[model samples]
Target: MTTLLIRDGVIDDADQIAGVHVRSWQAAYRGLIDQEVLDGLSIPDRAEGWRRNLSDPLPTIIGILVAERDGEIVGWTSFGSGREEEGAGDGEVYGIYADPAEWSTGVGRALLDAAEQRILDAGHTRAYLWVLDGNERADAFYARQGWVADGASKVEERPGMSLREHRRVKHLAGS
Candidate 1:
């Protein structure tokens, strides 16, 4: 295995990131999410969205990091100020995804670690992220990293149905 490189993402990385996004969701959410919703995902559409996001990124974005191995993007994460209504000291991890093929190879961990550090540097002591309900793998992974659900939940509307998600938070002050 080659060394995994975690670096700041650029606009040129949008296409590859989109590929990772679709594939990761499809694999990670296979049994947890509705199959139809995953099936409806279009790489081109996702790529377009990513292009726009990278091009006109919000000022609050602390940074976006991509984990690459052998010149390919295997994982990525984005973090910044809390998008949701939260206390003043909370940073937020918008999302993190890794190609399922790279699962358990430390790719996601690299991305998470980088995001946490970036979030801390953004002058916030607490960090939070949301995961779809019943995503045991994701929840367990976050737990391993010291994240805990804050009892905050929300329902998200997708194409055909509503999905429930819960917020997990970590205190970065002493870590």
Candidate 2:
């Protein structure tokens, strides 16, 4: 059995987190994302983005929870205050990714649970996230966890192309 633990990411986790983000996006977004957009993804670019997020002072409390197997980081989840104007009552899961080797090993689930708990503890009423429209696997996963789509779609750009993403939300206790 693999023992998994979640911890707050430190400043030094930028590189590791960026690598995980890029690899996971490539794996999870393969067929659903435009090839031209995915082609421009780079670890260095993502690292810089993460660095800025981590440096933000307020409203954007970015935290990276790492899933480790035998002391090796295999997956990560990032959560922060919602970016939308009205939905600030809940934290949003902006990024989630895991190593393909650790997929379905409960890593993603555990990370989400931890993130949601943190959000709730921080007084959030619920949690929400954006998922690309054609990501059936991800949609099913979120549905299984009690998330519901709000029938809203927004255009999102990766690097070279734009795609539509659906907003999904899960109500927390006392929401």
Candidate 3:
């Protein structure tokens, strides 16, 4: 494995990030989410959205980081202030995804570590993220990283189905 570089994401990374996002979702959420929804994901559309967000992020958005290996983007994460009215922490990891081909290659872990450090540097002592209820892979990964499910859950409405998600929290103090 080559060195994995974690860096702040720029607008130019939108296309690659979108590609990873869509591919990761298609692979990771296969049986957990509606097939139609996954099949309908458009890379171009996601790229445009990412482009806009990276270029002009909202105040709540703290940062976006990308993991690159051998000059290719293999994963990315976005983090920011908590969006929920009664969040478990002051900071939240909005999203994290690694290219399907790169799973277990430490890309996800690297990106996550960087996000956690960023949150800590921003003075947040704790942070949380939502994982699809049935995503055992993600659950195990987070567990290995010292995150625990906080028993909070919600149903998300999708095109043809309702998906459930659970919240996981990690204390960042003294880490």
Candidate 4:
């Protein structure tokens, strides 16, 4: 319930961000995804990837933002130029992950609001995101925020299995 701060991510926050990323998936996807696969997620590996991402961001990755409560990173979301795989749009929220303890605390929602604004600030008129097909909590959250499923889907390989992901889109007012 304290003030939640959202800010641009920096390389120094990689470790904390990684911690949240892995733990969040473990919690959020516990029943939704394969237990073994979720258990296999490594914080160190995630941190290394985040370090590379924050340290040497790609040109298309416009922003990576983190959510902090009392000075600790508890959530993050990254958005950028839209992926070629989606409907005609100029932006995409690659992901938003939060520490399990922080779930339902409004941090994820706040992070999403910030990501959308950042997308619009970058001159994107529409934005889209891919969410795991069966993540009911996420699906409902996105729906409440006005995102609609666009009937697009993809199967991605993960830990020796295939997982289905669906797309959601929203049009910005200025579009």
lDDT tens digits, residues 1-175, model 2?
8678788776677777788888888888898877666777899998897777666634676566887778777788888789878676678897788887777889889888888888778777788899988999889988888889999789976456787899999988853
Better by lDDT, candidate 2 or 1: 1
Candidate 3 weakest lDDT stretch, 10 residues: 81-90
- Model 1 clashing residue pairs (backbone): none
Q: List the residue pairs that clash in candidate 2.
A: none
Q: Pick the candidate with the highest lDDT.
A: 3
* Least well predicted 10-residue stretch by lDDT in candidate 4: 82-91
- Residue 173, model 3: Cα distance from true site in angstroms: 0.6
lDDT of 1 at 76: 90
In order of appearance, the predictions have TM-scores of 0.95, 0.89, 0.96, 0.94
lDDT of 2: 0.81
After TM-score superposition, what is the CA distance of residue 33 in candidate 3 from its true location, in Å? 0.9
Model 4 TM: 0.94
**Higher-lDDT candidate of 1 and 3:** 3
What tens digits encode model 3's per-residue C-alpha lDDT throughout 57-155?
A: 988888999999888889999998888878735899999999989999899999999999999888888999999988999999999999999998988
Over 37-104, each residue of candidate 1 has an lDDT whose tens digit, in order, gives 89988888988988888888887788889999998999999888988766556898988999999999
Instruction: Tally clashing residue pairs in candidate 4.
Output: 0
Query: What lDDT does each candidate get?
Result: 0.90, 0.81, 0.92, 0.88
